[model samples]
Target chain A: MKQLTELHAMVSKAVDELTFPAYPTDLYEPISYILSLGGKRLRPALLLMACDLFGGDVEKAIEPALAIEVFHNFTLMHDDIMDKAPLRRGKITVHEKWNANVAILSGDAMMVEANKFMMKVDDAILRRVMDVFNETATGVCEGQQIDMSFEQRNNVLIDEYLDMIRLKTAVLLGGTLKIGAIIGGATSTDAQLLYSFGVNLGIAFQLQDDILDVYGDPEKFGKQVGGDILSNKKTYLLIKALELANGDDANMLDHWLSVEQFNATEKVAAVTGVYDRLDIRNYAEDAMQTYADAAFNALDQIDLSEDRRQYLRQFADNLLVREY
Target chain B: MKQLTELHAMVSKAVDELTFPAYPTDLYEPISYILSLGGKRLRPALLLMACDLFGGDVEKAIEPALAIEVFHNFTLMHDDIMDKAPLRRGKITVHEKWNANVAILSGDAMMVEANKFMMKVDDAILRRVMDVFNETATGVCEGQQIDMSFEQRNNVLIDEYLDMIRLKTAVLLGGTLKIGAIIGGATSTDAQLLYSFGVNLGIAFQLQDDILDVYGDPEKFGKQVGGDILSNKKTYLLIKALELANGDDANMLDHWLSVEQFNATEKVAAVTGVYDRLDIRNYAEDAMQTYADAAFNALDQIDLSEDRRQYLRQFADNLLVREY
Candidate 1:
């Protein structure tokens, strides 16, 4: 089996080689631009890893792996527009660089391109792969809608937030693994087990992100600490704090959330103070570990050699143990 | 073969019966709302008609037909936002009613839904059908992008305009017919012929629309007479006029096009005058007839019985022979 780093490099090289039509510059250019502004390419690498783990032909998996990568970027392009994000991976976003209309149309084109790539699979499993893909894609949209709706309401429950993240972020990871496993010629049961492992790990990763947003080393986090708190974003930490805080702590949290203006450091310091007092970090960490453990348990059940299993475990460990 | 009316009714009924999940009302509601505000369902009806022409089971074609309808509306929803259009079919557009973000997201979900419906095809043909669907979809997006690009440029050629219309408007029609023919057990050669017929007919239909925009009876034409003139839209008549006019006619047409504000009726009349002087209407009619004849010639070459050929020819005639 290929090492994770080797698979990642392969995916990156394939992404670099991708080309789009040159005529409709407004439509195809943004697609090329967004794909060029590379992310970690983690999802596609995991897909290839899953395929290799199952003894499938990794070379044959490259195009479908690229499909997952393209699909991931497509979602990011659209989500950037919906989120009004100006930057992606430290570069200007497609919508900001072009316009919303261009982004929208180009993103639509990317979805078609993703599907075209997906059709490269052997014809026998085409239907099953597409069924999973469509469901995953649909869930992501629904999750985004729910997440947007949460912005207007103050009553978002923790479970609902978990469901939202699972839909928005986790399913794609799970679906990516499942597609790879299918391509790798794994049994349906084993494919679904890999999907479960990916999902739990995904949820844990997002919770890790929530924690890192508030507490990670400024140098390593690559974003402003407590930015979520400054925007009153309904992260798991904030939601849990909202549920558990009361009296003086509640009043302080309310003031911080409601205030129209404050010094950036002051706000972060103040909100982080509230979280510290309530030990919301511990609560978030506990939830993250629970999911992480669940992911390992699913991994344990999969029918791979211990060496390969340890390889996946180490990958998950490295993912969660980001420099902080 | 069932009558066109019967096929159309089947499509409408199928569309009406379509339902989406009720949660995330912001996302799903716009989808249902836009689908409910129906057009003629012409694309899907034609799909069903093509299927029946080849003696395919009409019932088996319903889901894919609905896929075409949903895909068409998905384009309209996004296009309305890009065009900043206020109304569609005399009702408020989805973007206008719900907001651009909602329209964008809902349109995205609808695209997924369209693919889901597309997957209902028989197993043996799913990949082939999807190839056509994705290619058709990608072309439509490219066409819209080119059409939008033209808004900022004055040098859009007649051939480029034709190409844009073909990509944006005609290919979906052609692709729809081809998909239907494939489902109806058509040989690849026959399917290509039907596709050619649809493409030529679609171009002719669009040209007829351009002519009607200037010259049709205001009462019979659903849209405001010469609305395209008020907007300085580069339709065939206007493009041809710009190419053909010189001296006084050139100055007048340029003055009207470049003017920021004017009485809508006067602009329409003056533009119509330019068209009359250039005999642009006849040019448009002759071009339309050339395509119409090409469509008939392709239809004649198809392997279908003469009776079935006449049925399709009659359908195309009625489509072109709208009230005005």
Candidate 2:
């Protein structure tokens, strides 16, 4: 547990130390600027934590962990530019802070640097790391693509959405933990179990995210509460509403989604009303719990000493039950 | 030689046939679109050539070759977005055809797919390939960042510019060839030498490109001749021009770069005038030859059969001497 805390500190320190060469000064400023806008170094931290749980040298893993973080942020920087996202972590995005072109170029460099840093890992684990990285990277892209494609689709089924999140969100969480486990010399089966645990927790986290978006305390929620509701984002609750809607319920849901402009509060209230009628919140919760239970089950299946397993399980439990 | 040609064909066919799963249908459309745009397929094809040159199965090498090609095109898509000069091979840039966001995401996916494809290689070769791939990927990014950094500077030296291009343009070419050689079962020393050959050739290729951008025949060049001239890009000629300019020459060069509204012909004529004053074009020609000679030297130094080396050298020679 103490090691996990120390590993977290190391990830933060590594993030602070990274700098892109400044010769063609314009190209790398965005790299610095984007990284400066902080998010939880969760993926890398998870990797470090997984390493520590198995008594691996945390120092040996930090560079690779940092590589994962840089790679993740690089995607976000470019993704923001692509999504025309105005803010990240409540700050103006890199593209917004700078411009789209700079963000795109710097982001490309960041990804390259990510691979460069991963090269620091020992050769013994290189292929295993790279192979998993390839799949994780591909999965993230697939998830994003699926997430975007939903915008045009009339029928984004619950299962399809689950798969999308699996690709986009869960796979990386799974992969990161699994990478850490593998690096720490976990058996392949143990790595699989760890990965499944992280991935299932990730889904629960996302589903909780959807719930909190509508029902959260605004101050605790950080950003605009009910943003997903207002934006008509195809979150689990909304998607389930679409699936469960009948008679007047269907009509109201369509009207709300189709409404080009409305008061934000009214939109939130209307959507919440529909959710209440169908108890979509419970549906989302049940679905979320199903995955969360799966994650715990996965953790239980791991062959680590029970104490190590419990620590990992406790973290997952905390992650699922968090308010923010 | 015939087998070499078959190797090239087989790698090309595999690259052409390689398809990534479309989880987010829109995410990778840009990749397919750009891959569809078609270039010489030189990088992957070179890998195959190197493989057979080393007496390795072209079949076993094909996926890794495709991986390299996929990587090459990913760089192009992202680079095109950064450079913002439309029309790669006379087609609209990915950002132009789709949005910047899609190009960025798809490009990321392409890079991931490249790694995924490489992971499928025999485990024996897979580790070394990933190491080379990591090195090349980082080198490419470093080169690009340096190139970008150079854009904002006034006193960039010729050697520094050469270094930048070596990172930006040459390393991947070297890397591509080395991967092929490695996969093809070339010895470590030979692979190292092959990498140098490819890198040196890449540097020469870029220098030739700079020359052709200003001087190539319009139709044969397949681009807007003098495009770099108009952009005030920091090419070898421009870097040399900055170093060599004196009296009125320096003033004229500065004025030309600062001018917002010069006719294309006027801009080209003025830039060419500066190039002539310092014999910058001749300096560039000499520099290009230096690199080309180095490439040939590397090729000659390899332990592989001279007859085998001859055809590849001949192909590269045609490139070095081409007017367009």
Candidate 3:
């Protein structure tokens, strides 16, 4: 709990320190605007905590910690432009606010800034850090590419979806955590363990998000509940429902899916019915907890002390067991 | 000439070595496709020559040398996507070939690969190389922003234009050469001198491109001539025309600028007359020479054998005086 406070305070400071230099006009102000319209600063905080837990100086880790977030935001800005998403975290996406051209250029500048920030990390760990960052960044792109490919396909298997999310979302956590542990003077083996832990946690976290997308209460979800069902987007429960639905329930699922126009409320009710008949909710829950358990196993394998590990585990558990 | 051969060979080898593991199918193939459609290996060759002139091992500097060109191409790829350009060097741009989504994602991967290649340099010089690279990359984005801003501005001075080109086009040349010299074991001061040399050469090179854009013979030019004039696209000549045209010529220029439709050839001819009356070509030539002189002056100040410096100077002269 105290370490979570430490994380909160450090993440706040890191976020606050990120401001754009005044340009001739408000040209680069979007860079600051997106970072200021904040989200959960979880990746960078995980990196900082991993560094501290591994006995590295947290101060030295802050720059790269910040680098990871800038890199993340840069990806978001560009991806939003490509996806034509209008909003992020209930705020205007960068492209929506300043047009796509500015969003693309500003996002490019932000990525460059992220690399510049990473270079500010001391040379002792710079090469290793760059290597890890490079792999993670590339993985993130690969993940995005895979996700886009899935849009054109109908029968995306559970394994394929898992791999896509791992690349798109999970490896960043592992990469950030490993960079911290490595910079903090962990041996190669310890760094690998930490990376695996973060990765498994990422997989579990994404599965949790998918479950919440359908089953969670609409008012408490803060965003759309069953939004994916309306869009006919492939998530775990839908793929499982397609796989497990028996005769007439399958026919009912097909009827809704085959429609030309979407009705969100009706779709949500129908899909929840299919999920209940097949007990797909429990299947998804069991699957998510398996990964969460695997993540804990990976964490336990690391050489970190119980106190340090306990805080991380508790934080992760709190994230997993949330109602909405 | 022998140095050019060595560089040409190295570039050929470097291009061949670009391989990303192909499992994810969508994520990395775009990068390989983009890099494989090669153009003139000008930037990397210049880097190798700069190193060889300063007596650095060409083998050791090859990856980092190639990094400059790779980084350059990465910019071209992303910029083309943003510009909605149809082709690059007569090849379909990555975005055009495989959609904007693939282009955007692959471009991100290429930028990371560029950093990975640079970090492969010796540990002692990695810090400085990254510092220069990070700075140059950010400068490039800033220059691009300014260039886009110019499209909306009615009055951009020649000095401001030069500065824009400095950030947009020249700093990376300086960065490439500086990294080459440092890897070759040039003293810090010698590296700075090499950067100056590259900067001056780059300015001249760009002015020459502007010159060729306006006046080169059609067959030898390899593209449309006076295209800048036809579009009323601001170039050095057009800016000078705005500053220097008198009476009837001024009115004609303004009319052409306002006219949305005209014969492209007639527009070219009309602008050519304005350029002749204003003697804009000669003024631009003198300006080009001034910067070329500055580059040579910096080369003269470098502490190297006169014979060795001759090759580097000649290499630059070859570029400055290109026909096609």
| Best candidate (score: DockQ) | 1
Q: Best candidate, lDDT-wise?
A: 1
Cα error, residue B265 of model 1, in Å, equals 1.9
RMSD of 1: 1.1
Pairs in steric clash, model 3: none
Better of 2 and 3 by TM-score: 3
For every model shown, what is its TM-score relative to the native structure?
A: 0.98, 0.91, 0.96
For model 2, the DockQ equals: 0.60
Interface RMSD of each: 0.6, 2.3, 1.8
User: Model 2, which residues run further than 4 Å from truth?
Assistant: A1-3, A17-29, A54-59, A219-224, B1-5, B149-156, B217-227, B230-233, B246-274
Q: What lDDT is obtained when candidate 1 is compared to the true structure?
A: 0.92
Task: Please write out the lDDT profile of model 1 over residues A240-315, one tens digit for every residue.
Answer: 9989999998998889989998998998898899899999999999999999999999999999999999999999
- Residue pairs with backbone overlap in model 2: A23-B149, A24-B148, A24-B149, A24-B150, A25-B149, A82-B101, A145-B24
Better of 1 and 2 by DockQ: 1
Residue A11 accuracy (lDDT) in model 3: 78
lDDT of 2 by residue, B1-324 (tens): 445456667766776776755546677677788888878887788888888788887778778888888888998988888888589988999888877667788888888788777777786776688789888887787787678767778999988999999988899999988998998888899899999999999999999888888777888877788899998999999988988899899999999989898898998998898887788878888888999999999889899777888887887888787665
Docking class of 3: medium
TM-score of chain B of each: 0.98, 0.94, 0.96
- Scanning candidate 2 chain B in windows of ten residues, the lowest lDDT window is B1-10
RMSD per model, one decimal: 1.1, 2.9, 1.9
The CAPRI quality class of candidate 1 comes to high
